[model samples]
Target chain A: MNSVLPNRAWTFISLLIAMVFLTLQNNSSAAQFLPNWPWLVMMFWVLTTPHKVNIGSAFIVGLLCDSLLAQPIGLFALLFSLSAYFMTTLSAHYKGLPIIQQSLYIGLFYGLFQLCLDVFSYASKPENSLELNLWPVGLVFVFWGAVQYSLERLSRPAPIE
Target chain B: MFNYGIHERIRIKTALASVSAVLLLILDLHFGMMNQARTYLYSITSPIQMVSAQISLQSKNLHQWLLNQEAQEETQAQLESENRMLKAQLLQFNHLKRENKELRALLSVSPSQFATRYRLAQIISIAQGSGQQVTQINKGSQHSIHAGDAVVDTQGLIGQIQHTSLLNSQVILITDPNQMIPVINQRTGLRGVVQGNIKNLKLRFIPQGSDIKTGDVLLTSGLGQHFPEGYPVATVDHITQHNNSEFLTVYAQPIAQLHQSSYVLILEQGAQ
Candidate 1:
């Protein structure tokens, strides 16, 4: 139990640092190629440790993301918390899934996430003529492949199982 | 503790959190009561953002340092010539400024007539999300930055301050979907409204036979009193007219370096 506390704390801190770093990269005009990394990080944590990353934690992180991005307050919070809940319910079966299947799950989840953001954005501001970008949905699969490979190489224990 | 049941507790908590999130969403959409909360959160994140920005700036400087010596020498020579030209122009510009100030005083249009005060702000972060075109700056209410204050780069009008926190603020760029600036055609002197989106600005309500042409410059008309007068906004890019329509579709590209630049002047309006 003592060892678990320190490990959990370190993991939480590392995740926060990663989120902040990703947020900074996202905001920089120099890096327009980076995707929604915070979302990926959140999803990774949720899949790996549902017991540790609760809905409240997701909500807070989402709110922080919204603030950093200058988006409508609570918009990301709502989306992220809902995603956390969905991931928590599916984590049991998800942990046992093969790498290919896991990548598909991430693609599906991220696709839905981007779709919701696009739809909400369009509805909120009709003048932008913002289209539901299927390209980002496609890109999520590619990103998941890279993210999963990196996570597998980095983690001491198997993250998926 | 009593057996509250872990699974039941998880289900109940998730439901509660989701409901609260929905409530927050409604509050944010309808009333915007959450802006204060957002401001506080932004303040908490400001330190990390500032450090990151500094790191990025340093890295960019290092990249420039690593460039070939010939390129560096060329840049230095160009800068020196530009500096000399600016110095020569500054003398004449100062004389003209003094004469203009005296004339304005004679006309009873002194500093009281408009915002002479401005605050220099550094762009901290831009909204990487889709839809809105907001940029965060280092100045905030502590620096007297208020909402609706006009922001401008060296080239032209950038946008208006949309929200203010203690040490930071959000600026809605002129290209944001919700932005509307009253602009006048520099060539024809015809007043029209310029609306913006992610793509480009559209000059709306233009008469079919309006003299606005491609490449015509547009400046803020200061009709709404939000932005100061005579700031360059955009240049007319394309014009389209349908046979049956009474209006022409005129698209303009913003003159402000909205994405590339990282600093701006926040115009603070004074008592008129």
Candidate 2:
């Protein structure tokens, strides 16, 4: 019964679904201003399931996104790997912080991810580079915190009476 | 201490991976050696994409099922009314079609020259940046979808397919900065290139003497064979002219609901 909760396989599957959902979410008309979900999701997994979402996995996800988006390959991979590394090493500290504070940290890291993407775009297509917006990063991180809280509550094993 | 209970091996591994990612990025950007590898990987990811698509579809269906009975009834009523109106329009449209064919025959022009076939596709995703806009559709090479096929909705041109895999294709929208479509001023038949701008479509290279107004409509001239002729492209919204400059700066709002439509049509050129 204890094994029924989300394990490595379940977590990996969930992350994949989340990544795909996020990809589709970008298609939504109202979600035009949302931050990149795959990056945030990678950071979440790095903090929660480091074994399943290692650096290699992060790079692969980023590479997949780059190809799917038709950008220069490896751009997302590089940024995602950097974010994963940061989250893995610093997530312990983040865990101890309050929810709002954790969101601040997530926003900062997500900003870094966006910054790298913008730099890549500018270099590759100077005329088409997008102006960066940091507000969406904060919004996404706050949403992520809420989602993480809900998942933790749902997945915690029932205590013996 | 350099670490707080974090394993030394993990730290080393992360550093190694980060460096590898940087190397991959440089290789990909400078050499573009990974395009083929990425395309091949899509064959593996298509199944995963299909599963997620089903999940999203089912959830949408579930949401509709959960709607209150009154709301569902009202929606059904609206749809039925809309269907009735469309049926009425269809009869008139058929009459107009016959007249159009007669006129073309009188002019000795073959109607087959203008004939086209379209496949309906669902928009699976849209990636929008400040100056970049790309959309992904569920149809791909499996459905005879090819790169450079024109994509449009009921209203006007949306984009053209940029890349395709087994079951999906990426469309670069008309608003993407990299995208350009040859267009003509429907009013005066003046030819020019409509280029994508971050905010609106720009009709570039038109001489200062060109008679273009704020409300002139633009249609594809079909010069590049990328987009078919006479399809509505945009409506001129703003026109600027410099006293000494040779060209006029004209901006037009796209007539197509580029960012709002959920479904699109992919025109397979020359197909009956």
Candidate 3:
């Protein structure tokens, strides 16, 4: 129990730091490659420790991201929270799946998130034309690969099992 | 503790998280109170930003220095030959002063304007977000820069100051969707409102039969009182005629390099 607390604390701090760095990089320029990092972090946390980092924490982090990045305030929060919840509920069934399969699934999840963000932004501001560049979506697969490799290396004894 | 259940603990935690998220969203949306707090917090973190910017600047400078050294080495022999040739050419050109003066007067000229009070400012930081594209300059209220003061660079009008802190001010660029400038065609004197489009500015409310044409210069009419009179805003790049509408759609490329430049001049209020 004592050991578990420190690990949880470290994970939380790492997630927070990732969120801040993502916000900074995303807000600086329109053409950036680093914004997808937070989604990877969120996905990794959800897959590894659902109980320790719940949907609520995801939502809060998403809200801060939205605020700092100046997207629709509640949009990212709501979507991220829902994504975490879905992952947590489905993690058990998918846990036995191969890493590449899991990464493809995560990439699809990120693509859907991007699609929703586009739809919401368009609906809110009709004047701004939607430029859907597939580059960011493609970049997510790279992040997914990294997440898969890192998670495997950092795997620990499953508390719930 | 005797009656506590696992489900109860989960519910309580979930509820607490939900409430907090809602509260944060409300604070972010309703009043922009959190934005103010964030700005204050950003000021505290600005030293870090400054250091990072300096590192990037130094790297760029180093690259430029290396390029200059290479160019000097490559040009050393050629420049020496060219210098002797240019000296001879200069002696020949010195006798053609009367011809040069006649040609200059025939060309189109920038109009003369009265001297105005100007405040030199360095861009401290650019707003880091999608919603508002603004730049913060080092000079602010302490420098007598009030809201609505026009900011310009050497080329032309850049923007107007929207908000001011003690040591910083936010300048909303002319390319921003929300910014509008009152302008007139310098050649035809046709007046129209130059509104910022997403990427460029468009002149709205110009009548279909207006004398405006491509390559005509647009100057601030000073009707808005926000910007000074006769500063170049943009050049008419294209004019489209609409069959059904009374107004002609005019698109002008902004003269100021709003994205690339780092320095600007904030015109002192009442100077114009």
Candidate 4:
């Protein structure tokens, strides 16, 4: 929550969030509404600084996440890069929309990301079904506004007297 | 780390990144080229995971304590949590009883028969999203927990260790679609393969008129030598066959308590 967080702080924060993500996955009670935190964070960064942090950064971050979380090795890498593609191309349209509508649009895309993941899973094993949970698709978007505000604040230069 | 000033190349770069990621996934899953890197990353992240889990648990307890200060709300929440805890405990008793019997039998068993050793492992985290019913356990390669070691609870077989690091390992649960275990009908001795069906499991490949019946208990047949023989896997719930279909669609409920088990036993066969 510092105004100017250090690099180590950022690394720690990422790891901390990764740790909480494990808890979120294990939380069977609210499985339907669990937002992909790292995806939200990566999306925020991509929208804010499209040129500096783009698809390549998304893929690397996802690779790191995949290793950290003990997922199928490059699973997160694939999901994040694909998401980065969608966000980079679609950011222009959402930029003109209101915050509420913007969140909804992003949520719609998140569902698409989930679909891509499930499709990949189905490819790996034909026994699974393609399930798209639309009920809580946008509900996970409730944190989008907060994520947007935080990233914006963190990126801002300190005000001069 | 990409910081290209040319905006035109961004789309091409994104496509390239996605393609590379897909390649990486295939290489990692099939060839396991990234296991060492994953293990090194685990060293960095697992500690944070343990700390965060503890902090989360503490925060929840504090919130529960605050709620408990009010008399009326206290009993309702208290009883609910207690009920949940009691249910989990009831499930755990099966392991303890089996362990007691097994340990006693091990005393007289020869070295060949005593090839298996059981170690208790704590579930660190479970996979999120659909089609990925995997979990990470606290024990890993250092603990001699090899990949494909059968993971069970007090009741029955749950899963097997899919991958192992120095300090932790990943388990693909029997409920995962990619995970399939060979099981046999305890009563009829009919053999079949059961695929993990997310929350439930489904028996596949059995012929339409196979002598399987509802309520038949399925035990691991150890066909692939993946899981040990004779551990209860699932109980047949029902079988439905479409007209002219060769295979009957069979639904079976898992005998093991799936995700609810906080602790599980890892069977390290031929443990040194």
Task: Give the Å shift of residue B222 in candidate 2.
Answer: 2.0
Q: Which prediction has the highest lDDT against the true structure?
A: 1
Q: Who wins the DockQ comparison?
A: 1
Work out the TM-score per prediction: 0.81, 0.75, 0.66, 0.72
Every candidate's DockQ is 0.50, 0.39, 0.19, 0.41
Name the 10 consecutive residues with the lowest summed lDDT in model 4 chain A. A6-15
lDDT of 3 at B27: 74
Q: Which has the better lDDT: candidate 1, or candidate 3?
A: 1
Residues B1-272 of candidate 4 have per-residue lDDT tens digits of: 76666555777777788788778777777886865776566666666556655665576668877764577577889989989998899679667756766777789752222225899998766666533577777888889888889999979998988767777777889988778899989999999999988778999999988998889999998778788777899999988989988999999999998878888999886442
Candidate numbers, best TM-score first, in rank order: 1, 2, 4, 3
Candidate 3 ranges beyond 4 A from true positions: A1-35, A67-72, A90-97, A121-130, A147-161, B1-55, B58-62, B65-130, B135-149, B162-170, B268-272
The candidates, ranked best first by lDDT, are 1, 2, 4, 3
lDDT (10s digit) by residue, model 3, range A1-161: 22334546656656655654554454356434444566678778778777777677777667655544445356567777767766877677778888778877887887788777677656645886875545667777666777656644444434653
Error of 4 at B154 (Å): 0.7
Report the C-alpha displacement of residue B8, candidate 1, in angstroms: 4.0
lDDT of 4 at A160: 50
Docking class of 2: acceptable
Candidate number with the higher TM-score (1 or 4): 1
What lDDT tens digits, residue by residue, belong to model 3 across residues B80-193? Answer: 998999889868865564455556667754332332688998775554334556776777678898888899997898999876666666688897767889998899888888
Per-residue CA lDDT of model 4 for A111-147, tens digit only, reads: 8876776677677666556665664566657767876
Provide interface RMSD per model, one decimal: 1.9, 3.3, 4.5, 3.2
Output the chain A TM-score of model 1: 0.80
Q: Which residue pairs in candidate 3 have backbone atoms (N, alpha carbon, C) closer than 3 angstroms, thus clashing?
A: none
Clashing pairs in 1: none
